[model samples]
Target: MGSRFVNLLARSCNGGPRHFSLHRMNPANLFHPTRSAVPAVQPLADAPLPPPALSFGWPGKKGELAWMNFMAFGRTGNNFLAVDQIGRTFFYDTDSRSLRTGMPMMCKPIMDPISIAVGDSLYVMSGNPGPSPGKHCFQALIHGRLPASDTNDWSWYSLQPPPPFVNDIPRFHEDEVKSSCGDVPAPYEIGAYTVVGESQIWVSTAGAGTYSYDTVSGAWSKVGNWSLPFRGRAEYIPEHNLWFGFTPNNLQLCTSDLTASSEVRPPVLQNMWTDVVRPKNWTLRDASLVPLGSGKVCIARFFVTHSDNFEDMSAYKKRENFAVLEGVEVLKAGWAHLRMVKHKSERYVFGRDLVIPL
Candidate 1:
């Protein structure tokens, strides 16, 4: 129920600094900056807050990284991509959290887009119309070379009549592709989407079940281990690999072949750890996975978590400030950089990723 985020936005249109009208659960922690180390400090004895991490660049456009509706990617802190409430998406380099500019023409009206970093390309797929569920749009990870050959020429085109929708698409491939093949994968499988080992697509469903899409054969198959439970499973791509969230209940991470695999696993955090919060019904909140320098990645996991029982609805406000999870890669492990989207007052704060006191 704590879905609505960003009481205030970045580059706000106010006279002073941006002000917000939302409450968040940011644990109290003080920033102790040393030589490459952030020693943590506690405000009181009750809550032991973690330390802070290196401040990477913002994961937004115009050097802006404050968008309520955004998304990010992965473990090593290498890639982080974000999509604002509007349809615009941003790709940032993790090291500096800096925006990378090389591939041009990234404007499109994609609703719910699935991202995958295959080989050298960032494939973005699916999206119907409006914010509501509808049709699907397809775009290539790698841009085709245009004859014009200008940096500005780099962009994606709309591939309509895309993978068939779960409802309207055929049940079997023999009837569709005419290959005498078995069941083929439909392009659209509702909101179910996944990325696996470099390149793969896995779609999870309640009725149709889990299945993988074979890009080459142009077919689909029921996923292995049908026994695996599916609660609030969601998928996204920032860069490098595919990300799948099995049961939003704790949201243990699992990876597999691009075509979907039977075995699934949980992801190790930047600091390689998990807290006491119970993850449930994960909606693709604000995400932006960017790679910092020195093999480090920073992912701002902006999703929501709730009690196993619907008890503590206090945090569930119709409006809330920007709650972000900033992941920073450490020496042997990784550290999370948690802080509130600072207000001009610097009095109120939002909480999440915090570097541990060492």
Candidate 2:
């Protein structure tokens, strides 16, 4: 995310010391095909595991834990903002390893809401409200800005809803024609979103194309009839001048020049790498890419195991719930080539608890 580089030492999976390139490159040639090569997956090194910096479970009641959905957004540095299904908010600081309560949201419970943090403000958008048969279920936009001081109160305010996807609209009988705009259903869940520059949030939805929301003016405008090439949140790195994120279908690590995307052309994948080789029985639940500054990154992936053969409910209950953390560094070779060096891999079990990186 930042352009500055730090001198960090890490060992590659092959047990050799790997140095991350600190040389800065021209932003204009960042996406040129001749400037880079396909990255190879190097094995991870076996190293001493570090002590856990923080550990906590669902912040909601035990009864609500089973059904409650949790989402987290990195506010700044080590500070993270978390929200549960019941609109409760929690703030966690990784640097201090402290967790504190925050002002609750004003909106109703939204399942698996999409969230992003830009500057001092955090935003939450479309999500499934609930299971209402024959009725639409989607939430509108709400955002909260960080208080300037400890004595100031924190709060969430409503914003204009995003434009709806044409295909996501529910079909109605001819006799049940609606009369007003309120009759139309809410928009579908967003496919992906990322902060552009320092003030604009770019959101992409299937069939609805792409749109940009200006944080300063609180205005939304159509960008193009195309969706973002990546899924979920894409991290923009100034060092390489590229946005890195997971591919939509397979979740492979990929990079693209998001700013180069236009009304007629979608963002093209400049480079891609298979960071993890998952097994057939291991189903991926969620994945996140965390930037550790410089050229270092941590890939966190949550998975659940399943049986190949038919099993009883009791046998299925015994399936393992675990997560894998992979450390990697993007290095510049010579003047044009780029390489991804695998550093370490660690796995942890969390039983039935859902784990996500902030």
Best by TM-score: 2
Q: Which ten residues in a row have the lowest lDDT in candidate 1?
A: 338-347
The runs of at least 3 residues in candidate 1 whose Cα sits more than 4 Å from the true structure, single-residue gaps closed, are 1-91, 94-108, 127-136, 147-153, 159-161, 165-192, 214-246, 249-358
lDDT tens readout by residue for model 1, 62-93: 64544422233333313445454344445554
For candidate 1, the lDDT comes to: 0.36
How high is the lDDT of residue 47 in model 1? Answer: 28
lDDT per residue as tens, model 2, 314-348? 65766766666666678766553467776556565
- How far does residue 107 in candidate 1 sit from its true spot (Å)? 7.5
Q: What is the lDDT of residue 160 in candidate 1?
A: 42
